[model samples]
Target chain A: MGRRKVTHQLISDNATRRVTFRKRKDGLLKKIYELTVLCGLPACAIIYSEYKDGPELWPNLNEVRSILNRLSELPVEKQTKYMMDQKDLMNKMIQDAEKKLEKEKMHTRAMKLGLMAGSNDLITDTDCSEELARAADVVDKKLKAIRERIKAVEAGAPIIKRD
Target chain B: MQSSNVTDCTMRKRGTKRKIEIEKRMTKQQRSVACSKRRPTLFSKAADLCLLSGANIAVFVTSPDENSDVVYSFSGYSHASEIVDCYLNNKSPPKTTINPESAKFWWEEPDLYRDCDDLSELRIIEDRLMRTKKHLMDYLEKKEKSHSVSKSDQNPNNDSGSSSSSSQIASDFGQNPSTLSPSSLKIVSFDQNSYSSLEPSSQVTTCFDQNPVFSVGSESSSDQSRYLVNEDSGFVDGLLCETEEENNGMRLPQETQTQPMFTEEDQSFWENLDVDDVFGLFKDDNNLEVPLQDHSSTNEDDELLIDISEYLSEEAMECPCFS
Candidate 1:
């Protein structure tokens, strides 16, 4: 009967997840309604659930569209500026990822080099040494590919969708 | 027997109250159900806030699945859009950052920029077309009004119906098929600038060649000119003025002046669009007009009555066919 606090993560169990979503969604809507009523502010909410046929909008669809239409009237330069800011953040993330990947690659390379120099301390089983080397090669290739993708995204290039 | 078994079943209850972890992946159905249930509660809260404080607030949410959005407004006697317009009007140079809470939910998220691009493109075209029509109506109305003082002088039926329909068709045709060409983009760009400066109007002929879609390098340029026409003709100003008068014992002439200038028909058209169909907004322009009598006057709400009469008179003034 005790109510224990849980983390705000997605629930994994099917039944629990469904129940949690329902309870939390209701709580959120209640908060929104209270904010409007107590503050007398003009507020709207659009909730789209995957299971629903269409999005569940608060108040009405017409009102939301009208607000969106007004928001969209913002000058093109302003919107473009917002996009540019996003691009900048993306580029920064890519750079950080690249640095992390470089450090990892060097560490892996050193281990392979040490193994080749007959440093048996790093490898427990002598029989699978070749396999270990091959696995490291595959990892290196995957990292390289990921870096390339990061570059492409930074350049505003269209990403090729993988089927 | 059930009480004795409680110790053995501790695991069942413990599992239900397990500690929360980091963001975990959720099933599509779970996510959907969560959104659906939470959405209504938010609106009810908004409604309550409006009634208690007499403050205007708008909440907008865009669903990830259907790419649809919902808005809740505590506008009281005023339409939601008018409240937003007043907000925007009061803050002309909107900050570079929009709503902080909603920013993450914006359709233009970096990964989803393509969809956002198409939508803004459509909005630009729609905004341009609205302004053009407004100007055309203005010119035609002025000419008609000057030529004859009496409403009986003009051809009411054919002109009102045809002009609106023809303009809609003309804009639709002009944008879609020839969107690739640069010449059309150039004309629209020119009009966009001139429109901002309050030039009398753009040449209607320039509209025939203008396109909404842009080529790669021109995104920044097009984005700069994407100033949407303010849909509010100052209805909020009038209402706000009324509010201020009750509180301050003095009248605000400036705000009152702007509302009546828009003419009743234009106000009705705008309001109806906000109140009516979403998908039908762009397509069905003609049939949406409800009879004037349909409006509520039961509470003897003088303000509502005045608004209705303004619309009726504007409709009469525009169409000679109507008695």
Candidate 2:
């Protein structure tokens, strides 16, 4: 059976959270092992939890110290070459999303102008086609309202407002 | 009949959907089993990342046992100390080590063909090969055009129109040998008082109205009475002999002689050339591997090579009849 989509939130129950943590912690350690072995690079992780007596160290304390020492020996510029903190990662993600949004907005504006000019050429894109369908629905509603108004005037009865 | 009934029951169980309560707490034994089973898969993925991107990584995880203080640690290197120390000293949060512009995550890199499936990997390789071939072809064509221009320039008797056209072609390639223009060719008298500023080894001075051509003597002579011609094979021979004599009678360097005078074989080679031949040349020369290893470094090297090639082509333009 296929798994359901996981909710991105912490488990409220203490027992369940502890269980999840153990499982995830093991998975994280395994990943670190694979990375170090496959890439032949220095890497170390330290994890702390209430369940454990002390913070867990991958590959032992000696290896972690060696990796850290090597990294510390490098110049500050070299050390930071590919480094990004949580804030930096978030900023980068935000910037990329904003750029994409701006591009999408421009595309939508162009599509709207094309529709207004009564040209179907811009309908080539799926997004443009969807937008066209929406515009057509609005136009249909407006036409129906106008038709109702005209009928009311011809019948000389009270005209109900429709939007 | 009993065996058939048992088989039917098994089939019914297999066909039933089992909804997992993802948020519910699992039993202690189930949790342990899950951790054990998932750990190997996680490690395998990390290994793949390390192998593909050459990135250093370290991970530490605390054990779930309530009384245990043991923290599991894994490192990409022999010891995780190097990475840990770097992190501690730098006080920077961990981020991806690969170029961010190329890929936010190492796994996202398209160039890591190892991660791609067979068809896509093949397509990437083919695309790279095609681009390399195109670049090689362009370089060869440029070299040929420059060679032809240099050849035309060697004939001093050629009309101004031909010289100008050759110059135009040379200019198109951004390599105009301005000093060696045919229109600027003139034989000026070698006056010791005026030419005394020239190098002591430059015994023969050939001057045009604009540019001066200085020729070193065959021997240590103070004589400035030798007349330098501005026309034909004689001038070329004098220049070559003067240059060769300076190098202890060694022929011009192989690099300067790269653009050989057009021959029937060369013409045929150009005619028969195709993508396969270019690809073969790349393979034979081992030029294809450099770009694959480090694209940025290779790009810088390629630019430098282009500059050197242009300089050499200009030198060739100045003395086309070296052979």
Candidate 3:
């Protein structure tokens, strides 16, 4: 029988959750063991549950201690060189997204200039050109209003401002 | 074809299998069996991930049995304790010395050092090219000045005196005027100070007199004929060979003797030189604003010469990174 796709969510029933946890725990331990063997790098995981009296150790207690000792021996700078937590990962992702947005904005500006110069080949997306045209119309309207205000001031007339 | 047929058979078998809900409540026996079977498959997946990405991972899981006190732990090649410790340490705030705002993962940092090294190497090559160009310009200027002086000296009364005198000298040397190519002529004793102090016409005459083989009245007509006979083979080669033989064991340095003297390659180097290419090297430098198309004014040429000299004398000598 083919296994049905399971939605990613917490199991609500206690019995079902326990069963699922047991299956997943075994699977996770096996995966970690395989990863250690294949990558030749030290990795360790600790899982806490209300059902367990003590956490299980992979390989054994002695190997885990030795690996921790090796990690501790490294200088703090070297240890932290590649280290990142949830917050750091999130911050990095946000920074990357912002940089991408800035690049896209610059590209859009260049495309708008190309459009104004009457080049159609620069139009990669119809929506982008439409948005740019709307923005251009808004800017043109603002410019006309500013020009009218300047002429009113030159003619020594009191101008009422409207938005 | 056989592999395709096997794949088709597997696909047919897969299609025939009934879908079972993985999330449905399972009996205790069924759950135990599923856990046992899935363990190896999960391990294989982890092994594949480790092999592909070189990631260090460790996972620990508690026993699901209410009576069981066992907590299982799994680690990659390294000890699980190390990864756990690293993870714990990473969970804490980083040191104050390290700016949190600028902190990036090792992979995120750009390889600026390699780019810097490339830029430095390019600067070295550009500097060398500029020095070579300056030397070539100085040589051509000296040659032009000497040629004009020689012409004026030869023809004080007539405009065609240089042509006539050259022909006379060529006849005296028993060679065609065209055969005495300017590129073949090597300056033996000329220096900047000597060139400035001595008259160009006198210096030109003295060059021939300085050589024993070419001393007009000193050598017999027959001896001159013998030297001229060898000259028919190659003017520069004959002169060098005769000089070496006459010097009686005096030999020039290997580099001096083997060094190429104004070959076609060198001629092409000058011909193919582009001012734009030289300027392009400094295009990214904000402090330097080289006028791309302006080379017509003598003042600009002088300024460029000064800039090249400054680069060669000051910057090149004191560039600590390259040194």
Candidate 4:
């Protein structure tokens, strides 16, 4: 009857709790459907009434479930917005990673060049094979770094690239 | 008539009061209170959805009902154990953990079963991991041995020690290389449940292997044909062609660029699709079949009504999926 703060411990009035639940539950399911439509994600909601024997659906729950289930087919309305934002982040990460790898490779390359340039005939740093090995090391380090990042997903094995 | 209207008013007044009483039922103060009250009902709806859609759902309801009862509902004719299996495995997804697939492994190796020896015990886990590490080390040793023993001419430079490195690298290089590459390079076959990759080195950097790797098949055009249809080189070649085309107005040869034939993915999509699932793109067949009538037949020629059916059909073909 009056706008008072509701404690949620238990509705002190018996008849009021039932009424409030019915209205709020319907609204809850509606909110869920709206979210699924707008968000395009798989969401299965369960509702159990305090008085009722079991949980019950609002409506159109099946259509919503199926839509969410076929996730790949579902138009990723989030894709465009998320792509723009995530692209910047992911590209930044990639560039950062690439730069880090480049620094590592340059450092390795410089070390190998120093080794070759400074060698007085200890090991055969004197051949094309050593040059190939140096290039191979840089590629190997870069690829391993990338592989570790990509392996975050389940997909396995990477295609090799020759410089 | 006045008396009847009074009686009607009483009835209407009573009905209105009853409706208002119903509205006073559920709490709507804070968002969390609303969520807590309505969560169970939401789960119930989700269970119904799973049943109606014939989708396997294994729900791990983080919260309980108003009475503090945890309820688990799977699809019809499924065991509680299976549903629990799906729930505990937690592979459903990060978002949809509320719904999980049935425990029916689509395809898997047989004879796998849980041991009664303290399945949840930390000691067992530690022991299993230790055994795994030991096996891995042994495997690496064997691989290094094999790699060193490969064709005498292949790695004539490196001491035979690299043979074992090659063998160890073979599995890691082939298996999970992602700690590094986002490019999902896979060799998939319909018969195989998943890619049964060869053992790779633990490091995952064998892709830069000095020597090229090739797969052989038994008496099949899949491999060793006079014209090698190298799936790996094809990707590089495609990239190169794309780059060349971008720089110099040229395209990959039409023969090499034949679009992939229909695949199981397309077939699976069709299988999942219902007969009536039109996606609502087609307007009507009557419009398609109806020929454009000549309005100039009975009158002098003014503006010619071009038959646009051909254009419609042509546009329809370009619509890849519907066609």
Q: Candidate 2, which segments miss by more than 4 Å at Cα?
A: A1-9, A77-83, A102-163, B1-323
DockQ class, candidate 3: incorrect
TM-score to true structure, per model: 0.19, 0.25, 0.24, 0.16
Measured with C-alpha atoms, the lDDT of residue A63 in candidate 3 is 65
The C-alpha stretches of model 1 lying farther than 4 A from their native spots are A76-163, B1-323
How much is the lDDT of residue B218 in candidate 4?
A: 28
lDDT of each: 0.45, 0.49, 0.48, 0.40
Q: What's the TM for model 3? A: 0.24
Please tell me how candidate 2 rates in CAPRI terms. Answer: incorrect
Task: Give lDDT: candidate 4, residue A118.
Answer: 71
Docking class of 4: incorrect
lDDT of 2 by residue, A1-163 (tens): 9997744333445576566666666666655554444333344665434454444566777876765555555566655543433234346557978999999987877668666557655446565565667667877999999998888899898766799
List DockQ, one per candidate, in order. 0.04, 0.04, 0.04, 0.01
What is the lDDT ranking, best to worst? 2, 3, 1, 4
CAPRI category for model 1:
incorrect
Q: Order the candidates by TM-score, highest first — what do you get?
A: 2, 3, 1, 4
Reference interface contacts recovered per candidate = 0.09, 0.09, 0.09, 0.01
**Comparing candidate 2 with candidate 4, which one achieves the higher lDDT?**
2
lDDT of 2 by residue, B182-277 (tens): 342323334433455443233232434344443333322323232323333123222211222222221112111111234455556556557677
Model 3 over residues B275-322: C-alpha lDDT tens digits?
Answer: 876544534555333333333545423332333444476667778865
